[model samples]
Target: MKDTGWIAATEFVRHPSMVGSAFPASARMVRRMLAPLDWSNIKTLVEYGPGSGRFTFEMLRRMRPDAQLIAIETSQAFVAKLREQCDDPRLVVVEGSARDVRRHIAAETCGRADCILTGLPFSTLGDAEADIIMHETALALKPTAVLAAYQMRTAIGPLIDRNFAQVRRDFEWCNIPPCHLYWATGPFKAPKTARLHLISSR
Candidate 1:
């Protein structure tokens, strides 16, 4: 089997539409994205666009022993690789789009997810597709559950604000091209109308 980096590059070359980034997320980026999460309360976690299982591995390492992780990937090759490499009974790798997060979670697990993480590039997706994914992700998460997503650009902030009750933005500079990390919580009765507040990481 080809190494993950090679596979990621090849996948990007072959299907840019499915695989958003040319490289897998760096370890630093993954850590920054998962930093504020409260692992004890997370029983069911869903990861969208888990390219090369970088974040998947990190989540499994720190998550509770009985916790379940559902990895939703659009790339068949990456999905196969995750199944082969991760080998954890708690991990469920599904080949699909983020737009069907609610369906995937319901089919794979008992209830809604406690958290959803993504490194998907919303800018590359069409407006309708992005909207569907954003709404579905919000629906899949339990009340007070968090959604953590990291992107190279900041364009998706407004869409996130529309879905979640509160949004907190942070920056991580350790990666090749740093990332904008958004940590959002809630599916409250009325979503917040506040703008994203950017905070610099120490």
Candidate 2:
């Protein structure tokens, strides 16, 4: 198991009532999700619900010096903590809900994003709220943009169908409880029906 420091940090940052864990993706997985991205064409990247800035820090590290990173987090405590933790001028930490993706980006970054890394737990969201957030996400994305979301839930067909042209599951069995990562492209046709392998732990 990874050290408890990371564990504690995540828990401290995530909303107390939130069902999802604050655990950040392993560095390897993070790199893989971002590898296909053409960094040269990417001037801005937005991260939704960046708990403790795990992926936020990583994105900052990998982006070109001219590139900027915007992390939209709703928790006030997490936002204050992150503000203290990160000092990079290229990084902008916004303490607000990602549901307002377009306004948040337009006000802070002043441009549409080339890549978006989301860590929200859609499984907990109501259908109406989910639809609104998803729609806003599409509006915020550049035509060629990619949105990579990490979900611990195996059943993401609804999300995949509603928002993506294609859905690829990059499974990491080594992680605790394991996880199913999703990569999606904007303006995708919703699938009629889809099946996925659901794993149950003893």
Winner by lDDT: 1
Q: Over the stretch 1-202, how does candidate 2's per-residue lDDT look in tens digits?
A: 3343454456645543342664556766666767766778778899988776667887887888999888988766667777888799989999887788888888876768888888677766666666677767766887788888777774455766566676666876655446678777764432222222222221
Which model scores highest in TM-score? 1
Model 2 gets an lDDT of: 0.71
Q: How far in Å is the alpha carbon of 58 misplaced in model 1?
A: 0.5
For all the candidates, what are their Cα RMSDs to the real structure? 6.5, 7.8
Error of 1 at 163 (Å): 0.6
Task: Give the alpha-carbon lDDT of every model.
Answer: 0.85, 0.71
Can you give the lDDT of residue 177 in candidate 2?
Answer: 44
Q: List the residue pairs that clash in candidate 1.
A: none
Q: Find the 10 residues in a row with the least total lDDT in model 1.
A: 193-202
- Candidate 2 residues lying further than 4 Å off, grouped into runs, are 1-19, 188-202
Q: What tens-digit string does per-residue lDDT give for candidate 1 at 112-192?
A: 889999888887787778777887788788897999999888867977978887889999888766889999988643333
